[model samples]
Target: MARKVYGISGMHCASCAAIIEKRLTAIEGVRHAEVNFATEKATVELDSRAPSLDSINDRLRPLGYLLLDETHDQGAAESETAHQATPKEREEAKELRKNRNTVRLALPSAILMVALMLYGMLFRPLPHTLYNPLAMILATIILFGPGRTFLRGVASFLRYGAATMDTLVGLGTATAYGYSAAITLFPPVRDFLGAGTHTYFDTTIIVIGFVLSGKYLESRSKTRTGETIEKLIGLQTKSALLVRDGKETLVDVSEVRRGSLLRVKPGAVIPVDGIIAAGDGTIDESAVSGEPVPVDKGPGDSVTGGTINRRGSFTFTAMQVGSKTMLSRIIAMVEEAQGSRAPIQNLADRVAAVFVPVVLVLALLDLLLWLTLGTRFMGFTEALPLALNSFIAILVIACPCALGLATPTAIIVGVGRGAENGILIRNAEALEKLAVADTVVFDKTGTVTTGRPAVTDIVALDTGTAASRILQLAASVERLSEHPLAGAIVEAAERDGTELLECSQFRSEEGLGVSALVEGREVRVRKPTAGESARPEAAALLEEGKTVAVLEREGRAIAILALADTIKENARSAVEALKRQGIQTVMITGDRAETAEHIAREAGIDTVISGVLPAGKAERIANLQQEGRTVAMVGDGINDAPALAVADAGIAMATGTDIAIAAAGVTILKGDVGKVPLAIGLSRATLRVVKRNLFWAFFYNILAIPLAGGAFYPIFGLLLHPALAGTAMAGSSLSVVASSLWLKRMKIG
Candidate 1:
């Protein structure tokens, strides 16, 4: 299957989006389609040999909408430079002007309609010559001018069998105007009905007035939702100073090639992803990592594009430019994530799919039932106009716009909030999954404890050499190895400024240790097995949660080196937070029982599973699942990939291996253990908002539909006016949007 995103035009409400989504999904070879009303974009997944763009557009043209190609707006949409007006910005500006014009037209129509309704009901009715022509002129201008889009939508619906909110509004207003115009133009029709019966001129104009004003407010609020992406793009610097052979030349950031040295001064954003080649500086990486603290960057340290250098100057060799840069990748990830539909949204889509058709059927039945029964039970003079008013009110009030706006609006705001707090929620499903996970399993090495291990204990078995000399010899042999423990030993030696002898014929034993000829003596460093004559000091170190290595020279035990990893500062606090939320925390590791327990205890984990190999990790996660626990695994290495994939929600630290990140569902940008609970909290909060929005959207329609159908007339002697019904429909959609907007102010982190 292949997936693509296309810009859609002429979506007025959620019902319009639903119509497009349904039609697109019905196409042959198309697997799924999601149309987001707020974003005004449709994401479609289809077979490789699916329909062509022309065919897709052919299906949509009759629906009064257009699909724009991905590359159509090259300069505006795809440009990395952010200072220029983007395609989205241009669209928003145009919408603002259109809204102003709509309001200007709608206000006059509304005032005229109010005066006409009051004159007919409160006092004596005006003559047809005076009131009919004035109402006719105002209603026509409102319907054809500010309300032209709905008329076009209705025309498209008639031709293409497409039904939407626009169709309902247009049909309702047109019926009122057509009936009223007939009564005005022909004096016989007015006399045939009754002397007191007045034209329904106010209903036509007032409905259009409510719709235009509602659309203006909806458009403005929708524009604010895309500000997150705009702000992120704004962080990119437009130009950089390229350094070549001691000469610097200014160039666009996009023009900087990989491996080109770029000079960055203090107070300037890093132009691209690169490694520090010279000098040192403090870089503020909050834009990408959400870490407020400034990070120190020196030679060999990586600096991401869009980060600001706070102090000192530096020269960095660009490693990733353009779209491959870290900031660009983040923006792309967020866009895709925001566009994805959650499973919860399916319910709303399914409801919206049938909502418009059902509403149309009910509206027709309402008119037929009332006209047939009301004419005999009451009288034609009193019943016909009331039946007509009832039909118009039913059609105007039943809007699928609220249903369509329910989930996507909340998801967009929730996901955008997550991004703001250094949490990269991969998709809507992951966000939903994280909310319900009951158990969280942490990989010990890089998750609970800091992955970096340091030499904690050194013991000399015999008097062959001093402690410093023993460390030097061990470091010399270990330098040839790439294991984490080996690196620790090498680092300890370097930190102490110890002189190391050269090693030759270096060889490493898998899962055991390294061997080398150091100072012309065969030296070996290996983990002690069962019954090995390890010193009491080494055993003590192991008991204290340190990994001990036995070093021997010339068949004699010479020294022992013990290295231990320290727990993260925030791990315990994060675990405690999860516990408070009624979530169980477990630590899984391949370390010795004592070592694992020590780390787990420090991290406040309730359960510890130690001595588990790489393959056993997934099995352990599966066992937890069998126990009915919704597991969330957190890891940052290749070995943890299987476990990450097996769990309900896999959270990967951004600093970990690429495989780990690929296996995980969520990635914490700064690799902070505390973000684990933060992600879950945000998910739960977002889901709550989604449920609330869905509930209100459904409830609003259910209650409003019945009332608009004149269900309350028999008991309360009340009928919903078409103008009031239109106002209620507008309010329902705006209420859902407003509730979703509340998520932006939530304190997720």
Candidate 2:
């Protein structure tokens, strides 16, 4: 199945989101649909013959949803977002204004209602004709003023024959106000019905007031979750010094394009990803890679956007601009991850899909049972009052607001916190699964050991050829080959200040290594075969697990050169941390058994799967999965891509190649092996918050719904008031959002 993601608008609650998912999956070509209410986005799965996005969006418009073009937003992101504020920021400001309007009305009305109730208690109550009019004015002000949002929600949501939290709030308050108006203005109706002379103006006023107050608090918490994105967007450089034909002119950063030469001065952020064409600088790339040490970059070295130049100056040709830059992709990936659904959210979606309608049915039953049965025991007047209060309470208390907010709120806060710590989570599901991973498989090179190989030991066997001379000749010949070992040999010769002689007739074998003519002698550098491996010098080097190569001249071995990659400093401690957390650690390598075991032992990994080719790496991961293990593959090389995709969770170092990062579910910046344990720890912490939110929502509904329905009225003589029910319902949603926001206080990777 093919997948597509789109920003969504007009979703007010979980039921509103679930409604869209239902309608989209009902479409002919769409296979599955998931609409996340918190992030206001949809992830859809489609088949080979899926309808166009435009056609599908047309279907959704009638259902009160719009599929926004996120691709357009991303394309214009680096320019428009930097110069102007994002559309989401504008929406947040608008929402805050609306909340303020509700608060201004609700506060005064609440104070006036309390004053009137106190007046009635302290002295003789005003006559029905006078007091009822005062109450009517207050209720009217609260309902249509602060309650307009719910009224609008009712019109937009209920037209499609669906219901949400807004539907229940609007319908319950409307029912109380309308019924009170009829009884107050036309008293004959109440007398003829013989129920009561009292009007429910207080119920109408208090319910909307409490609900609006809860919304005000919720908006504040949500704003805190977006701070990370705001900080990241603010990091983009505003302007650049464009170098055109040897003349430099100041211009906006957005004007930068591919191949445009730009002069970056000391203490200025690089405008975009580019390569230095002239001069050099000390660049502080901590903003992009989270490595604090400034790196010395010279001509031909690449510099990323948003990085600060600490010293010197250089002119670089821009290679990537706008949304193609690194910062923009990170922002996009973070947004996508926050909008994604975890597997645990399936339960919440299934419940929310049918929650409001089920609550409506239960509320109707509550009214009918009280009116028919309770009227006989207590007569018409008293029972009628119980029936009305119970009916309204059931509607207000069982709104499903908290249930809808359970998972997505936690995911948003978790993803935002991860971004601040330089860990990028691609989707919510990865965080969930990685938290419970049983085994973590690490690629030996670049993950646990330093990928940069260095010459460890050089032994001269032929008395005439000195150790320095052997290295100089070998480095000269190997320099012609483009291999990691070749680079190590060249660097060793350069470090020792050895003068390398020129080589002729340079030729290379695939596995046997390079051969050339140096100083009129046939110089051959190759790995030892089975017979040659038995020699004293070769055997000693192989036992130590170094990459052993022989330098041969005139068909006689002159020297044995061994290269070894150093183990990462934190690798052993990282492995120990995983073990302490009840996770098994294994090493996967293409090296010989001796070499693989040496690196594994150094990294505190007891299990070493050696001699596995790149293609076979995925097979090993699949075999581990077949054994019922949740395996997480950690690597920083292109060969790890397939294995990373095949594992239960893929953790890639941002220092690695792009393909590895693209394939992995989680990417850690700074290339520190210690970050592996931190990533898993952060996932576990986030999952705990999600679970706590879900548990509270489910527990609140189960315990509160029956009490609001007056289930214990006969035995305990207890009935909850409609006003208190609305306040509790509002508090439930606020509590769930607050629980998610609490994730910010926890330590992140």
Candidate 3:
């Protein structure tokens, strides 16, 4: 079965929602139909074979409700829907619609309640003739007006041969209304002299009013708790600068096409995936990568859509546009995951299925037991009140408000906090697993180090001039090349503000370093000479195992520049923090053993697995698990995908490729390695909050239900009034929401 959700237009009120729900439910093989007037959407569950897509669309169109496009599973049909609104827009629209509906439902209900209260307070002892008629009219509107959702919910539950929180509520309110109507219409005959007058009209109105208020508050709070994705979507710009036939035009971001050349101005959001063809700039990719610092980019470098270009303008050919963009995919994944039911929700659903019938049977048994005790002490009239209270109390108290709030509240807070810190926890279970991760496997290149090569030390083999001067000449030539080592050499010279002599006739070797005519002489920077020195100072540096860029001019070695992929500034501190929390940190890389060992030692990593291929990393993770470690793999490359999937949990960098994010369970938005520890702390806190919420929900009802059902009447003769029972029920739901709100203030490490 495939689940589908679509925005349902033309639903003007709650009644219209009911009509659409009924129409959808009439379709054979439709398992569930939830039509929310506020969200203006219908979430339908159906067997794939029952109705074709065209058939479903045809049926909905005639009912004045347009079934908008179905949101396919993430990455399922990326190429087809280029102009579709992102998942974030859809979510926000749904929320807006829902809030509007809630207000519509709540405002009239509140006004009716105030009117009912005024009538009760002002005319307490009205003539019996006037009292019953006035109360009956007020009770009927409350029962069938604001209370209609409960009636529909009960009817749906009955049709499906299951029960829910709605079943209990519907039964309770219906019984109160029926009893009140019976007494009002058919005045009881007096047994001896005086007539007995008892009408439950006020009780019926009070229950419906209080319950509606609680439902409204709960709906608003849950909606607010789950707005993180909407906030993420708001980060994207609406349009892009497209260059066509030598003319620049501003186009909707969705209209930008692949192979189209886009001109990104300074401080503009890169609107499509493209390679940097010209110009130098720094991009603030924190939106995508969660890295605090902006990364420098120039000609030939690739840039993703949604990232901001911070420094200079560049023109690049778009490789991916619209839904194929990375931002769209992330938004889609988050939306689908949010709609997907968690394990706990599934359990609650199952329990609710059987819960209504059981309560109804218990209510029937209570009525029977009271009747069999004989009419000496109490007649049917007296026994009915007790029986009705039990039924109403059961429905009102048994709602899984706490159960519903438990996981979702925690997940919302956890994911929201994680995103704020640059960590994107895709699902609740990932957060739960991360809290208990014992071993963390890191990808060496991008995960630990900056992944960019840089010149560390310069050694002059034959000193005619200073080694710095040799580096200056080399930096000048290498500046024109796009190689990693070339950028490193140039960056080192630029950092020192060293004056680079002009160079002409620059030629780059594909795998080897560049050669150029510098200052009218041939200067070549390449791999080390084999026979120059077994114990050369450069050889010692190489043995310590750094990548050394050797510079030679006119066939005489001038200087050796030691280069290595330097560790990120936060990598060392993050490793230490993990260690303090008892998490073992390890590095897995395809680099040579000596270089890996050097990085591991400097970063304070406990284990080093070097020269491992992408598949080998997965095997290493499996091996670690066999040795009884709950491993978590942290990586940001396509090579890391296999290992990330194989580990107990995977933490990918937000700046990582789509394949890596798709494979990993967690993606850190902020490129800060420190978020790894923060994720763990958040998971722990969230789990704690969920458990506490569930416990209180269970404990409150376990104690309150018996008290309301007159369990304490035998001891202190104190039976809870039906009016107070409604208040307590509202209070219980309020308490659960309050507990969840406390999670918002929790401080994570």
Best by lDDT: 1
What would the per-residue lDDT of candidate 3 be over residues 474-539, giving only the tens digit for each residue? 898888888877888999998889988888888888777788888789998887756644547777
The parts of candidate 2 lying over 4 Å away from their true place are 1-6, 25-32, 44-67, 71-89, 118-128, 152-159, 457-538, 548-561
Q: In order, what lDDT does every prediction score?
A: 0.85, 0.84, 0.71
Model 2: per-residue Cα lDDT over 1-749, one tens digit each: 88878767666678888888888988999999888887777888899889888898798876667776555444356553364544544555776788887888886676666567678789866687887888889889888888876776667656777687777888788888888888888889878768565777878888888877777777776667666777777778778899987799998777778999999999988878899999999999776665678999999999988888999999999898988887778887888888889999989888888988898888889888888898888887888788888888988888676777888888888877787777889999998989889899999899998888989888888888888899998998998998889999999999999888888999999988899999888999898778667888778878878888889988988888999997898999999999888899999999899888888887889699999999999999999999999999999899999999999999998889999999999999767888898889889888998889999999998988899888999999989988889889888888998888888898653
- lDDT value for candidate 3? 0.71
Model 1, range 254-366, lDDT digits (tens) per residue? Answer: 67889999999989889889999999999998877888999998999999998999999999999987777878877877777777788898898888878887998999998
The number of clashing residue pairs in each candidate reads 0, 0, 9
Off by over 4 Å in 1: 26-31, 46-52, 72-96, 115-129, 455-540, 548-562
* Cα error of candidate 3 at position 349, Å: 3.8
Best by TM-score: 1
Instruction: Record all residue pairs in model 3 with backbone atoms less than 3 Å apart, i.e. clashing.
Output: 38-97, 38-98, 39-98, 290-669, 290-670, 290-671, 291-671, 422-669, 422-670
Answer with 2 or 3, whichever has the higher TM-score.
2
Rank ordering of all candidates by lDDT, starting from the highest: 1, 2, 3
